[model samples]
Target: MEAHGPHADDDLVTMLTRTGERVPHPDFDRYAEDLDAATLRRMWHDMTVVRGFDNEATSLQRQGELGLWVQSLGQEAAQIGSGHALNGNDFVFPSYREHGVALTRGVDLPEILRIFRGLQHGAWDPEAHRFHLYTLVIGAHSLHATGYAMAMDRDGLVGTGDPARDGAVVCYFGDGATSQGDVNEAMVFAAVHDAPVVFFVQNNQFAISEPVTRQSRVPLAQRGAGFGIPAVRVDGNDVVACYAVTRWALERARSGGGPVLIEAFTYRMGAHTTSDDPTRYRTRADESYWAERDPIARLDAYLSSLGELGDDAREAVAAEVKELGRRTRETVRSWEVPAVASMFEHVYAEPHATVDAERAWFERYERSFAEQGVHA
Candidate 1:
């Protein structure tokens, strides 16, 4: 099926295609220069496998193994593309549904599940992967990223004229977050201070049942203009475009070009979370429309053109992903829940009047459970 729909644009920054065709483009192609056959293949394989992991996570939620699962089903390219554009020292502040980005940053899949399973606040170290824990507080992490970027400038970690030492910040949020005061304020701070941060908005169309149309009068990309941040809108499903656009923005930020905004026009193929019923709000027709524009299918077709993705290669990837799914399921089952008192342990890490009282009260409650023979 060819492109169909009312709003489809022919000039969309599409390089790879659903057919085995790689179109030539000055901007989109140059950024993909280092994407040798192996790297392109890896991108394809990573998208496929991370999508597999996303599916398993959703299944586990359905089966009650996880308390909630935020599906990255239709938005894989947006996450992985921008994610791969980051430098090693670049810090990432992600919204809740960035599983693909987490995979790119080498975060353990089980640790990701731990957050959704309600087993831990955030199970991994941010410093290890340079990827912060999921921030479900809507677009609030944008402020965190901005503050971190400012701190980097003060610490002389950025704008030292050394690509090897300079660090930048990438903050992820959704179109829904644009309606937030916190997000707008962060933009203000970023532009005013010229913070080395990129505000990456994954405009996945719906902010839970409300469509993007209801949220903004103009394209979300224009929002950055008010704050003086150069903004660009990219076809988020096209991982190549996403990577290129984000790489440009990140490099600009890293080079002390200040903050940039990238509006990734993608769709959330699944519910807001397992708790959401997208069927109540969105139509099947809309889903079908985007299904034809599936990111994985497009890249796979491009890879096939190069004869890089043979049947054997696909089979091997499928087997590896199957094992990954199996491992994730088992890990979810075998994982231990944290102790109740342990919550208070992290509340302060030091003695505080109010916290101490809360801890003492919590301990008393636990002792009461023991006295009542409530041992598990």
Candidate 2:
């Protein structure tokens, strides 16, 4: 389905336009009005910084610095806007490719690169950052988020009218994951318990090479309706729309409104990962079509029109992004991988006979490699 202006019948909410226009919305516009110049500028910075680092990471993967890389190239607005809407205390669960969300949460570059570089099972502590480890197992994180939110509810911490104490959970995933039983089960559990969770699905038009049509007869946003969750579709390319919609959803969940689902209508501009080839599965025409709706360009246009992003400001932001990219590249290159034996050390929280036996066998196998003069 094609994206359109915010309307109840169309079910697509568009507050910002690709041509640097602002869609008329009496309610949603309040969120934009409350945004100061500095905040808008920061959003612009966040998008550029994420884009710059994303490009650098992709390059590093091509250069063999990483085993695989997933680019958040075109979906920056969807991720960044929603990411920024969360408070520091609100927990976030991510799929493997939510680099933009990690950046928004103030995670360091090397910590994010460590997993793709095959160094760590989890680089950052979820309890510390309120951003959980990247859940590479597709839809598993949704269940995790729902469970956490349910705990928050049981603790009576969600609707306390306190910013620092009241917290909601945001779960990020792609359109394809919605088809998984885990995601559906999560939605059911969340709705049934009135869990303080917002399901943010970035419908990037593809689940690998398969189009979204093959995954659902209706739009993915409507999937929540079957489970009694309120869902809204947003123009994912428009950062303002994404932020406003996510803010509304999260606030609703925090205030005992139950789980809300937001389908961020977006397009993936690159391959599914460094190992995949977009040209083999997608068309050049599709790229051209989404190119015109580039989120960064749209924000730049609005900023430029308002004299907030003059040439000097643009140059300044560009320089900062370049430095960020450089630092990210350098830090990732300098990261040291843990020793192979260290993996076995953390296999169990407490020692177990089976784990000890496996570790002993693994050590024996490694020692044999040295004795046999093997290249392992």
Candidate 3:
């Protein structure tokens, strides 16, 4: 099948399609040169740890340690591959399921746990890591990314003929979010302005209970062409392909090539979120199909073929991930739930009179309850 959109020719389609039996791309080779053996091993370990973390978070939600959890169990490669492809200067606008991306960008795992636990809003500063806060409002982050890119363009930060200073913005959303009006507007703005941004749509086949076929008659990448943006589709389960494609897109954007849409052909192995049940709408067969093409398993096969992975290494990675999960859980549980007063903070740098009065009243009300020794 043509990997890209209907608008692309056979040559472009072939260039974007899964390559060999292994599906390795030449771009992977170019980028792999910058990644050493240690980096590869770290990537493997990071995936394992993040998956473990995800599983633990889900379990915690089930056990009431969290109010909710968004599981990214099967989409690790899509997150990690694109996450690692970015530099420190690049900004990432993520949807709620980007736990792996958050981890890759150095957002503390416990901090994310705090969000789902209902103890905090967002625990990290965007300036500190260049990772924007998670956008639960579906495709809203797409516009935020477009605006950021426009700001970069205005500040002469893009296309300075220097790759180092020229940063790209990556906006992540699922196949479901593409249906949102904000997403369409974002593409329109991005294309018209030639913004240095990448619209990364992880097409996981289903948008909650709805299938991809129901969303559009044609592939999602094809939609980009209507907006005058170039697009590509890659086997998202293939980490090498994802990393290479994302790197290329970002590099192109940074070099004044404008925006690119990447439709990552992946599958959401788990439910949409912790509250969802896949069995309600999908069958075991469907789940098994994606499981068979598991991203980590595919990478393991490729690494083993190169004599880079073995049982011992796998076991070591597993052990490390296990420890990481344990530590994350402990840290999350030990975190002090922010005081109620904290809600008043960060609402505005300068306090408004109305907000100040309301906050003072709330504080007094809370203290009065304490003074009265009210125990429900």
Name the regions of candidate 3 deviating beyond 4 angstroms: 1-21, 24-37, 367-376
Q: TM-scores, in order shown? A: 0.95, 0.94, 0.90
TM-score of 1: 0.95
Q: What is the model-wide C-alpha lDDT for candidate 2?
A: 0.86
In the range 1-376, model 1's lDDT, one tens digit per residue, is 1232312345456666655477767776778777777877888888999899999999999999999888889899899888889889799999998888998999987679998889787988899999998999998899999999999988898878898899899999999999999999999999999999999999888899998877886778878889999888788888888888888888888888999999888889889999999999988998998898898888888888778889998999999999999999999999887787777766675778998898899899889979999995
lDDT of 2 by residue, 1-376 (tens): 3443221226568877889877777667776666776787889888888888889899999999999998999999998889888887689999988888998887875578889999887889778888999988989989999999999988988898887788899999998999899999999999999999999999888889887777876778777779999898898889898899988888888887889999998888888999888898778887998899999999888887787887777788789888987887889889887778788776777888987888889999999989999976
Residue 62 of model 1 has an lDDT of: 95
Instruction: Flag clash pairs in model 2.
Output: none
Clash pairs, candidate 3, are: none
Instruction: List the lowest-lDDT window of 10 residues for candidate 3.
Output: 11-20
lDDT values of the candidates?
0.86, 0.86, 0.80
- Candidate 2 runs further than 4 Å off: 1-10, 351-353, 369-376
Which candidate has the highest TM-score of all? 1
